[model samples]
Target chain A: MNLKRTTLIPLDDDSLAESIFKSFIEKEMMLLMVIIGDTDTIREAIPKADNLAQLSYFKMERWVLWVRNYEILSETLKKHLKASDADKSKEDYNNIKCLCFSPILDKVDGIILKNAELSYASLQQSFFKAQAHDALAVNI
Target chain B: MYYLKRISTLVLVCFTIGIQAQIISVIENDKDQKRTISLTDKQIVDINSSLEIQLSKLQLLDAIQQQFPQLKQHLELESKLIKLQQALRNQSAVISILEKQLATASEQATFFEIMNGFLTDIQNDPLLNERYNDLMAKFFSTDTFAPGTVPEPYIFSNLNNDMLQIEQELASLEADIYAVSVLAFKKDSSGGDRVHIQNYDTYTNRDYVTIKRWVTSLSTEQKQQLEALNDIAKQNNLKKTNVFNELKIKLLEEFKSITCIKDFKNNSIEFINNIQLNDVVPTEVKNKIEQLNLLITRFETLFLLLKTDMDQWQITLLLDIKSEVETIVTLLKTIDTNFSDVTTLINQTRVKTKFMPLVSEFNTCYATINKDFETLKQGAALLFNLQNNYIANKAIGTEVLAFTLDNLPDKGYINLKGTGQRKNGDELLIELVLRLPSAVENAPEQVVTIEQREFIMQLTGPRSEVAIGLIFANPINKEDLNLQNDRNFFYTPSAALLLKFGSNKSHFYNDFLDFGIGLNFATPDFNTDGTPEFGTGIITTAFKNIISAGVNYNLTLDSFYWFFGVNLPFNLPGIPINNIKN
Candidate 1:
């Protein structure tokens, strides 16, 4: 699959990334959005971005992470997973919450998103490159 | 409104009244002796009930006459009932005519047999038989049809026509009022208003698909067990279809095996919720399903909180889930899976959502309708009970069927006309019949009945009487001796007012040997020239007041005198014997 990257400016605020989400649909792509950042600004923007995302099997898929403290968030999530798995009533096996952040987005702050150059002539930055690669993998 | 009630008792009391231990006073004709009647308990009950029924009819009629004067409107209402009956009768008559015609047409359906009879006669004659055989040989052929397989349902041969033509037309018709006139109680009518049942949108007819969520996680111990389980699975040639359950069972053998949280997986939550629980879905039910699905999703996260020992929100969510599930379960259970109509669906939809209130509503509707129906039923019962008679509100007459008598006391002359019958030469039965006008239920009542009283009676006879008289004094008085011999005695008026007793049956004081004392007014014969002055005196009565000889002394006259007379209202002298014969 050929990979392409898309960059979103004005990301350092508690505002919905409507333009980016709309762009994915305009570019004739599956409606998938994965927001990744480790900042207070990113944490506050989760609900703001969530308002724009239609959460339904027939609608769109959303994977968001507003990592305040990476260790605390990861441990908290792991603890939940461990405890929930122990609970038979939860039946969490089918409700597999995908923690997909391996070869795609990294623990970059909102400043990186704001500082990333709009490479109109070139392909994209590495972070954008990784997002495009993730998007392409989803398309395949 | 209750004018007709208990008219039976009124009729009974009018004639034979039982005073002592079921003994009835029945006056019968000596020769005819209509019926030797004894009032048995059952017979009394029957008579009372029948009389009550009869009298209720009469009373209703009278009440309808007096209270409801809308006779013309009532007759108009009756016209509807008459029309209904007429229509039924007319329909029956038409059906009868149709049946007769149908029977006639049935007999005419043997035309083929009639033709065969002629053909048989021809064949019986020898000369014709030869021609008939020749013709049969020429015309008659094999009884086989064209060779083709019969259709699965070859019904053409079974469609035998009756060939009886029946034509019907309306010769005469009456379509005005008689065609239809019906009366029935309806809501929001002239008398009072009634409400219509409401239609709720959530009364679903479709069965909702259940949404289930599954949890999957693994611990280090379960992961270690998975290798052996996988080996076992490979030995059994097991796959996802069969081995998952075994794997799950194996995983659960150890505690804290977060490896496999469940043995089953159903990822149809999003499928059903998106496709089915949509726009056309029953809104309230849809909302509940959506809310429940939301809670199940929330429980997944809440489970995390519960395990993490964040107690507050988890407990609330669990309680909410339990309550909401109970509500939905009860509601769904009440739904009839096979309801034939919308009414049943709505009724079922209004399940025990709020257990107390909903059940109370059902009971309320039932009780209200029941009470109203009972009222209407009582009214209809009353109307039907009024079969053929009208009881009277007021009854007045001079005489009735019978009279009873009591034995008189022996004190003095009672100044009454009494007839007594001595039974077995021991007990006396006095027939106290009077030819005076009588009344019942307050209509100027008068019963001139004199109980067999003693010889002596109170002067007022249980009712007050003021007596007045014209009197003449004798000349033996010292004051009157000074007057001329011709004017020695003077004409004067006398009067008395007496307080009476024994008037009511309850008062037995002076009941038999009756006596009365009262003050009187008379003349003071002081002037010797035949003029007298009037003054007061004291008076008394005796001998049942039968011989009321007026020999009273005058308190005003201050003299002793002799006189014979009567009267408070009118004065008459010299006519003795206290006569009240009128």
Candidate 2:
């Protein structure tokens, strides 16, 4: 066996950054990225994703995501600042793409996801429907 | 005085002899003389005293001659010995003069060593002329230490602020790169090796741990430099901060690879190219060069001093200088570490005890650098040696064949007969591969076969050459029936040597197969209990996958081969459980 040749591929800045993120995630399993951008843009219509269900609720071992633009809240900084560069000011306008979002509470058992999202009237009706169906299913 | 003593002893001896012989002689000379009987007190006392004194003088002379035979060459040794003793009391002044001369010589040698070290330091430093002047001024001045003057605090504070600014700039740059997901940076103005640290996204393409390590090293260096300045400030009694000390200790614990070779005209042609000043060099590089110079001088001095210690070989001095060089190399590394907790912990102990941690860290970081330097050094020496012993181009063209054949004849030879050739006064490599098969009863229908792959490279020089070969075989064959008489092919090559043990190639092949003999000292392939009972030649059906039915001499044996090599491959013929519907 012999080494025939070796080639190094050139990558654009954004792609290179994504590749670096992927590599880190592969090595470390789960990592956090704090992204900063315009607040309204992030809050508008939900972001398009290839694997939404897998990402929407991270139940598996490893997951990754990009925050649209949640500007940094440091009082001294004027514009949105990347979390990694939070130590420095954002006058240079370095955007942080991914900010870590981990939920501390899991209230799914007490209040189901659908019930949690429903209004008071819809929640009451849904609760009744759940109880009735559950009782019927148990009886049968 | 000597004659008087000798005369008295002679008179006593004569008296004693006369007494013993008196009666006999008296009879013979009775009429000639009458014997005197009367004696006086003064005469007796004088005779006794003379006898005692004569005996004592004789004893003294004998003792003097025994101890100082050289002293008797010109004068009576006894008198000369007494005079010599008296002279010792008066020679204290001369002894002192000799001791003073010895001390002066020693001091002069030390001064030479120190001067050589200083010269080397100046040679290595970038600001060579300025450093030379400063060193000269410092050396010439009487006060080595300016006792009470502290360096200004504001200078260090400014340095700290500048470092902070650099850190801030780096942090900002990092954030921008992360946002953009930029993983790598193209080689810019400085060099191809440089990587922009701020962009975490681009860093994903590289080993994060390794990258983190490099950045940590640079960060630590910058921190330590600031700390050193701060230390200078503190020593001068300037106001000090706790962070500088912390930084120092951290830096001390870290080991950074040295860049001592400077630069190449290109990476390949360093021999013809001169070292450029801009290349990254090791820390304390100047001091190290000076230390090396001192060692060389010390070696030279001791070599010169061999004449003085001719009775004993001068190797003692040479050994001392070599040991000193090794110690200095270690010392330079130890001194390079920062003044952090690690440094403090190490420094708290004696120098002997403190060196352990410092050396371990330096070794860990400098491992790659040291390996590279050693390779370059060896390569340069070898190339020089080769150049000096130039070989003719015509001699290199003569090809030498190196092939290993199995004990079985025609079916087992991988050499493309005599096609090998040398090029440009260098050797070309040729490898031999062969397979042999043998059969047995009470087993699978196909006979078991052994596959041998022999790797050999023949260095055919002018008229003569050397060949080094290794053979690795799989599924080795053996003959059995009698425990002691069983013969088997070796599973691996047994020998490696640099010798010119020659034999005819044809005879080697004939004896190897016909007589069932192999290379001398070749390790046996199988033990008595495991030797296979085989007959016909075994052949492999397909490469790595299908094995020709092997005759199993013993059905109890789990694996067919008696022993296995380190590179023994384990694979079962295809029995796939899963298949795709195409």
Candidate 3:
């Protein structure tokens, strides 16, 4: 099943944002996210993400956002849906999710999710892998 | 006392006689002694010669005394004859001088008389007066003649020459009039005029050519007037033709150049400008061109505005397409039908907040384009209407000009026919219309019709081909017809035959005044009673023809029936026929 979701991340936590992006890529999930912060931090984060994957990135100082491993994301969605269904998938997702980022929670608005099962599976798998690795290290 | 005076007188006389005799004897004795004493042989011869000379002198004296009375009478007669001859020579010389003066005075008077006639004609005609004034202004300081402001010698010479030519022409005209008068007199004396009066039945007809030849002789001024009128008419025709032709050519050229809407607008503007620039163009045509230009300008402005609106709308459409493509690409990449990723994309790009305004702008642009299109359509239609009107008016003007030129009056009658349905059941029509030229230029044109004073006879029957009627209309009005005052207005009136044809019963009147015959055919109808019944009526109308009065009679037959009526025709004095001959 095709999975699409929008979630907010804190502005100061670069590691978490990077971790979230890497985890989504490993799971072959499409991750489009907005970073609400100062221009210097967003600008620094854009290059790090560019080195990791070929993606669409917009540098709006007021609202900075980036996409990573977009080709893999398209392949994953195509594999799950029929050709006709895939044609309208982008428009449907745009209709559901907000395309702006804000620093304040009140200004954040709501996160939108499409095909939530894949998003939940990708997140759960990532946590389990981390836990497994930790148990192995402790046993050694 | 008488006897004594006689006796003394007798005594005085005797004493005086005796003394005279004695003195005579002494004087004779002294003369004989003197003569004898002076005598010699030679002296005696000389004395004898002297005595003989003296005797001859006395004889000559006696003869002179006898012839003196006859000689004196002859001398007196000779002196009187010489005086009378001198007086005769003086009188002859005076007569010759007076005759020359009279001839010169007569010539000057004739010239002035002819000039006066010309001035009178000019005064009567506004156009001619204007031309005359213009011509006079060229030669004189003022149009009015003033004493001591004599024209240049050459001007006078030219005028004199022209006057002389006119004098000769007038003399020729007078001679012709005299010739015709002589002919008329001869005809009268030869019993031709009497024959017409005494034996009217035998006088078949007056030869129109001969009569016309006699009557149509024009005076010099009249000939000149006709020539001037013809010249004016020709010039007017030329002006009208030139103006219309130029307009037609210009319009055609403009139409040819107008391909696109822009070209149409530009070319139309140029055409209008060209027309405006032309001084020779008629005012109505100029006004029409101006109207056309206004319409074209409006059309161009509206069309350009519409195009600009469409351009904006198209740009907005392209932008919307780009946005749509971006949205589709995002969806393909993210597989997010719920649009959560798209919302996030929009949030990251900061484009989401601007979408509603963009959509509103697109809507506004589309609406503007539509409104502009509507305005352009209306403007285009208005422009088309102006063009059509201009073309139609041009056609009408061209036709009128052509007709005026082609149908300039010749020596013949023009017939015009018109028909109309009356509000009341009858048909008002001109069946056989006759229009005669006023016989001279500057006279009002008039038409002869049945509405004029006339006599009519009709034969009507249901079985007849048509309800046939005969009409003899009186002469046209003197003012309108321009008939000569000297002409006898009384003549056999012109005749026409009216035949009603077809179901609506249209009347077709054919003139037979020139002895031309015509026939019309129509299907016969039966009366409602199944019998062949005929119905007839008479009505009079005025202003349909030249002013006048009339009477009518009709005979209708079932087998045979008669109907009759009288109609009076009159004209309102000031009103004229709407369409008169040119």
What TM-score does chain B alone reach in each candidate, compared with the true chain B?
A: 0.20, 0.13, 0.17
Per-prediction CA RMSD (Å): 53.9, 50.2, 69.5
Output the worst ten-in-a-row residue range by lDDT, candidate 2 chain A: A106-115
List TM-scores for all candidates, in order: 0.17, 0.12, 0.15
Worst 10 residues of 3 chain B by lDDT: B177-186
Model 3 C-alpha lDDT versus the unseen true structure: 0.29
Q: Pairing residues by index, what is the TM-score of model 1?
A: 0.17
- Grade the docking of candidate 1: incorrect
- What C-alpha lDDT does candidate 1 achieve relative to the native structure? 0.30
Worst 10 residues of 1 chain B by lDDT: B45-54
Per-candidate interface DockQ score: 0.00, 0.00, 0.00
Docking class of 2: incorrect
Give the per-residue lDDT digits (tens) of candidate 2, residues B435-536. Answer: 111135322122111111111121111112111122222233333323353345333322211112111122232222211111111222334345432322
lDDT (CA) for every model shown?
0.30, 0.27, 0.29
Q: Show model 2 residue runs off by greater than 4 Å.
A: A1-140, B1-104, B123-128, B131-582
Interface RMSD measured for model 3: 65.2
RMSD of candidate 2 to the true fold?
Answer: 50.2
The TM-score of predicted model 2 comes to 0.12
DockQ of 3: 0.00
Residues B486-534, candidate 1, lDDT per residue (tens digit)?
Answer: 5654555565565444321222334333454555567655554455566
